[model samples]
Target: MTSRNRSTRVSILSALIGATLAVPAAFAGQVDTAGIQSDGSYARLVVKYRDSARLRTAAADRVAETIAGAAARAGIAGGVARGGAALPLSASRLRATASQADVVRLSRALDANQTQALLRQIAADPSVEFVQVDRRLTHTRLPDVRPMLVPNDNYYQQYQWHLHDAIGGIGAESAWETSTGEGVVVAVLDTGITAHPDMDANMLEGYDFITDAFVSRRDSDERVPGAADLGDWNPVANECYAGSPVTDSSWHGTHTAGTVAELTDNATGMAGVAHDAKVLPVRVLGRCGGYTSDIADAIVWASGGEVDGVPTNASPAEVINMSLGGGGACDTLTQDAINGAVSRGTVVVVAAGNQGQDAANHSPASCANVINVGATGITGIKAYYSNYGNLVDLSAPGGGVTDGNPDGYVWQAINSGATVPEDPTYGGMAGTSMAAPHVAGIVALIQSAVEVPKTPAEIEAILKESARAFASAPSQPMGAGIVDAPAALALALDGGGEEPCEPGEPGCEEEPPIDSTPITSGQVVTGLSGVAGTEGLYRIEVPAGMRNLNVLTYGGTGDVSVYVSRGSEPGADEHDWASTRPGTNETVRVANPEAGVYYVKVVGESLYARVNLQARYN
Candidate 1:
């Protein structure tokens, strides 16, 4: 399709917000959590009331009373909105119409040790719906210092090996055949982007959440218009902070933005992972990093929430790309905001911290419900500096600058100058930061597929399930393997699996005598037994390292049999595991099974039995 034709289709679909936000029903009541400081105190607490509508409709007196009641219930003598005190409305510079009167500020008199108790008391009160600790986060990328060859697009292909390299790349070419992320909006929250020839047209007006004038390096105290990169250089004469050394601006956000949706086929610069997708360039980082409060507000606003003190975002993102982070754990503040974004249908892709240690120690990455990405080098091994352990959900090419070759670095658009008159140029950087945008770009492609919008959980499942297995496992496990954009897209569009099979001994009239549905872990399939003595058959493709496979049947008055078989066909010797007995629930769990397709049989012992079968693999 031509550009003009595709543009119209995108406009029509733009209204389909959070088209893919599928999360487990069990997590609904829990507050999104993140890292905790050792000081026994999270800098802040995000208190959400039982009703969101109250923020907009409640009168001043009522709002004030609600705040007072919550604080008093928590036994806070000072550290909160006191009764009859002038209300301190939670506000952000960008959200002009937002009402933060619902958020009660903790009093300064309270010590960090007193927080947990007060928080518990506040939480026990029925008035509070959700609360999270305000944790700190820093940019996940570190420092480094790319052109090369490719097919068609005469741009910076040689330097962008991470985009097409067979060793560790996502195979951008094949994935582009299906989608260019035409209608998707990917929000980048970082130091911000500068004017770059390759990415200007793809940019959206974003807010500056860095409220400190010194850190913002701007004349104003609050947020302003376009998301421009005002050099982050901390000169020697004016150190960014006490004991901080002067350094050059990284233009970190600009580089990540370039990787996600920089203009492609235009042939002026490198092709982006999702060329046609729009970028919502959010500025959340600045000199000496940024505050967690500012970052949290950006996450809320980016997901289309009414963040107090800031205007509602005109273009809410379907995928939020956060390449920046600090260490600790998943802080409650960041986690809660992330949950809000995910709840609104946004797929958040975060960089595993650059620290070469267990990723479980990192925030957001370890937080619930987000896709945490690790970095791999051109050799397809975990990058030396990339975080490892179970927390990493997947891995991507973040470049290996020290692999004895400059070619290993992922290259993209940036400004060479340290501070002002932006000079559009290209360079290479190596970190988990570079890996995240790759996933974000692919997420845009997945979201823009003709198939239905996928929830964050579904999207993660697809990306992990479809990843190309590494030739050999890394020293540390890095998810299922490197992300395979083409494979992930194909699986995503397939819509989980084929329809379920009808009840019968053979289940079908075919020669195989079985019709199976494609199944991923955590998927539940329901079917009717039709009549007594008949059975419902299903097939599951269990990936490698899947240590547990459990099949359970629930509901129906009649007796039902549940069994797991080793092959595609259910036979006499095929039963590797079985749970037989009459009752409402029957379960069979296999601790170890050969990596291959497994068949599940649900037998009905009575007339018209309604059975719900679910398969779980981990």
Candidate 2:
């Protein structure tokens, strides 16, 4: 893929599936305009006005009064957070959309299709800038993946193939050398993270944004601090509806959060991409998935915006990762929230989706300025279940089932029990849901390495500019090729200054073929492993009579070994041995050689390359 930008439109999809985030679970098949918990005829609307001035002054009340009057005239009776006509439950339907603004999100049971007419009334009002109704979102899990697999305390070498994937992994190994994502915060708007032993060190106090009492498993209808995953399990007995069925809890947020900032090199569980990054678990999803209103509020609050009724967020996140999405055009509410976040310098990353269809139809991912991530299999091709289309910003190891091996799925922390949140354990689950966090983790890493810290736009530029080219282009366009951590980090560590390149421009710095291309001494070059049996050859012009020489290889996964040979192509007979036990890193050192020229051959035990190679002569 080239660096040339491709056609893009602002859009978003729904979230929640596979224990991931978003999508009110019970609504997976319920597309009617009913509120997530209401019997029917319930809709949430986001209304904004043209006059930004009147919003912050005494006129704010006047603008709101005008809106309330218009709604009443249009047969709408709900007040802010339900302060309108009757039923305290109305409070659940009304709330200020933003602080110091007439922008308001109001919910009410309108006559069938009457919500659009109400929006039209609101839009016709002289003070209104725009209006949008919330759409229904649902979550669905697919068949499990299978793979042949490892165990590491800080390493989980075999299981975390996605981190070290030679072709599609995010390239975490080398990235850690430059930045461990020490100071950045990633706010995960999902079911909230579990209290996993592997993630406690990097976890921060968060909030519960699920406002629906039934969906939140709460006795009251209020949101609270301390976001915790109580398991989004729907009982077959049907309290949510007449026929809502029971399903297994995905513990999806646990998996997503674990991937983003799970404790790394801690001698337990699996390694997170951004080891030192802190995760702010925002509970936007629960029992049946989550309400769009709650999700939208979380997005705004995470980026440091004020959502009335919720406490002011003191720990605003630099990066926001939403793995859940729904199908539809970008809603004004969600879009506005994302816009506000990006404007505030927060990098938002979302999954393209697992529907295996064009991603143009998904929210959040379709939304503007978001990094929509698609899933790649162990083979580096698009994952079978991943959604595609021009909307995707990039691809990452979402993990795919290979030969019925479950290990093909990206593995992370999960609950031990089936229906309830329980003991911490680990498992592999596949979806575009599993792919978004990889890039979010890297965003934290990039934020950590830069001096002044990059704006979301600049961070995205570095990510696209330094990404490795795909071994094989996906059937449909995937964003700027797969994400390459080490390469991206190197550019970031150099105080990145690359602009956002046009998508799919060939022969650019981002898509160079370096594995087989030889380079001179000391300069670091980026390259990929491609397929099995392919090797990168590097020639270093050794100065005559050099006392010592060292060849080192770090980053990528699989078993890649390095061999150095002088006076001939490096092979079994002429090379000095420097094999180190059985790990991903390789190095070969030579002493006191009469130097002419030396060649380094990188051999993969199982088709790996995407490595950072360096040769030093003294």
Candidate 3:
């Protein structure tokens, strides 16, 4: 994929009136004494009343009361309380006033021992659901350097360049065939983006759902009302702290957004796969790990806002990209919200996770409604750190841990200044996080090339059928196979065309009995000793009401595979199903098998070995 370069320029537009408002910093006298650090700067307090039945009516009141009582006892100056569903109780950031005593007294009063007592006292209240120290945020670091790209390497190029080649390149000659991702608005739910050269022209309207302060600025900016800044909220900076500190890691969000829809062919930094598609930036993560409740709100808002406080999202996104995950089971509330997004015609795409375990243990990605994407190396093999499972829908190049080749992975960085580099600049990184955007880009390309809008089910079907299966991939690791852009686009454009089988159809006919043996339930169908391979070929007939059909091989050393089609003569290399493995018994299930006599071919695994077959339905 060739990279594009555009001149860098920065534009500071007039701020919208209501867009620049600052949140009030009044502490309702709540002092969160649980898990206060020795430094007296940070404390871990479990949020109170996260899911109270009367939360809608008295949430603010309950939070205010808790803060007031804690402040009075601890002699804390003031503090801030934020709502979070993931925690059972409200957490506060408190400061000890001068009258309260010196730093030593404050520390002694709110130390671990005191904190435990405070928790016990708070638990006596029936309204308080639970309380515990807020856990500190942690992250696994990625190597900080650009990976080297091999010479003339086409495979490692950016997604857009490959897409351009698939559509016959950049001039008017290819105008009619050019792909534009219509009806596909991708939601970049991450840290806020910096107005970089490549992204300034492509980004759509987005909001900071993280800091309630509503000020849009960089991380280093002082805590002033109505000030815009970049970076995560730092709770230690202010007494009534509601945010975390910003760090270099915060740039991840901007970089990811650029890869999905950076302005293309404009001689800019780099071309994104679907340059014309809109991006909905939903800020969720900040300095420390964001609260689950905030991330949940971002999801709902990105999907068109089913919850209150979030204004009704104007342009409901068609795709949501969550590059973050936590160690936990799929939560009911979170999963329900994802399902709600899908029901509203949105396709949620999530990282398979960087944990290198089966994704079933994680939330959202493991959730049934979204598409879980795993990471692949430049050589088209699975990335060492990528998680895998039957739940994984597909795989894409996510740049290897130590094998950066062909310009590494050069994507736009979030919060990068106006002077960001242009050309095929490389930055090496590995994780399922990088793999997801590739799939999102492919989905955009497929949508752009096809006329009819495909449902999530149809899109998934097309992707699975067009995937390039590999024998070297681990059984549960790589999924159906690596993603093929050209193949996927071709399938999308074909409207997933169908073929038929039966008497009168092109390659249809009746078949003679095999090996002079009569068919029986327990007997395995063996080699073609009696029947002619060409003249005696017959298709298995499927009846109605059957949702699934399976073709099995009882015993064989040769390859055995199944194909389902409406057409008797299948198109070149377009079999509905194909497998190359030999086993004592192998079963291939066909979903919603159609009512037709579909050809089931059994080929030899090795030229000299014989294969046997059997069929079952459910």
Candidate 4:
């Protein structure tokens, strides 16, 4: 594929306007306060009202009255205040969330504590469904100095080890021979993008979803066309937050976009994972960080959903990469967006955050129906700053700059600008933010490699089933393993299983029966046996709200280990929970297991027979 000039392509973005957004199903409970700060700093609230004729067509005044009513009922007092000045808590309808909930917003920024209290009040109202603070999420990159070798790309051999290095790479070089992600579109939702000659040819028209004029750095609050990198440089002290570090523009989106779809074999820059694919650069982040509301809209629009004011996407993305996140569980707004995208067949991949904590506490990363990615160093160990835990679905090379390996950073195209757009150059950055695009690009490769596009579920299964085991044991659970592009593509192309051999092919034989046997709760299976280095895979469908899930193996002669994981197959070393006793008897229990398909792998440490396995949850 040849590169094309941007000036010659028709723009796909148009004027952004306010409209009702589609929301997800009713999430009953106290509003999500996971990311809400209690520091008393100023912030706004995202409120979703029960669908009523009044709310669907309510005016701004009516919405305000609803807020007042909720506050009064909660026994709160006093008007909202900002900067020590009394301000009217105005309301504005954004759009219906995917749940069909009427999403409204409080315009006046109130004290964080006050806002949280108000959110609870709003959530308690009979007419209100859910409410939460529209927390800001930043790009998850850790700054580092940045080359690579491969496919005649100048930097591939020197700097892009994350693509082909057997120890840590995604096997992209070999996968490229099978698929270059041709005809696939990957939407990059981040700080927009910069003009880089190396990636310019593969760029698609994208939109800016930022609504705040202050954050968008525009004169008007209205969303505009074109998702250009406007430089989110924090020029003033504490502009983002009190004592927030002053830093230059990250050009984060450009780097990620380059990783996803930069032109390959151009003989000038580093190779991209899916160079034949196109990038739809949706700008959601800006100065300081972007709001959850804006990012959610980007997710919806990029996946070909309707967003009020923005034109329908000319080229809906098959994969969406969000290398941004912040503290919090999955918020309703973001989850609804992701749910819609997944239902539309878009594979959503997100960063596991750079907080070095459980990703379960992070929004988007913790969101269901999305592939959560953690970062790995050059040695294929979990990055020290990458978030971990059960929610992380997989790990990828995100570089280990802070781990003292300067050359281990993921390198890609970036701008030389400090405050605005500058000359295009290459650099390295570390974090799970860098890890996500690698997976996203692999998704594109798999999507393009097969004759039929795999569903989001199928894609996820292929990635996990084909992933290479981590080179070393991680300090924390880093997911199934590192994504292997060639393996994944091959799996997809082989009809999601072993490719059928030709009748006359040499060494061809009948395939063995699949080992995936369904096990129900409180059921015990007898006569389970396996030889050393062999394993039996079983699954249990744990319905929602299952507590005390217990899987026990006993009455067996051999030494067997039990490995359990949710939603995907588990390996001896990669599972959510494990029990390896000296004998065949082993037990793994969970206090409150999330409702999903739990996979159990019974591996034989030594050869023996006559085993009984029981999985029961109350």
Clash totals, every prediction: 30, 52, 44, 25
Candidate 3 — which residues are off by over 4 angstroms?
1-177, 211-229, 232-247, 401-410, 414-428, 469-475, 497-550, 553-618
lDDT of 2 by residue, 263-376 (tens): 877688798989899999998877767766678889899999888888999899999999887765556567668889999989999888888888877776777778888888
Q: Which tens-of-lDDT digit does each residue in 65-177 have in candidate 4? A: 77777656545555546667554455666554334444465555667667666666666555666677778889998843333122234877777888888888888889999
- What's the residue-level lDDT of 478 in candidate 3? 53
lDDT for each residue of candidate 1 in 56-77, tens digit (9 for 90 to 100): 6554444345444545654555
lDDT of each: 0.70, 0.69, 0.51, 0.78
- TM-score to native of every candidate shown: 0.67, 0.67, 0.61, 0.80
Model 1: weakest 10-residue lDDT segment is 4-13
**Residue 307 local lDDT, model 4:** 85
C-alpha RMSD in Å of predicted model 2 compared with the true structure = 15.9
Worst 10 residues of 2 by lDDT: 1-10
Point out the higher-scoring one by lDDT: 3 or 4: 4
Give me the displacement of residue 419 in model 3, in angstroms.
16
Scored by TM-score, the top model is: 4
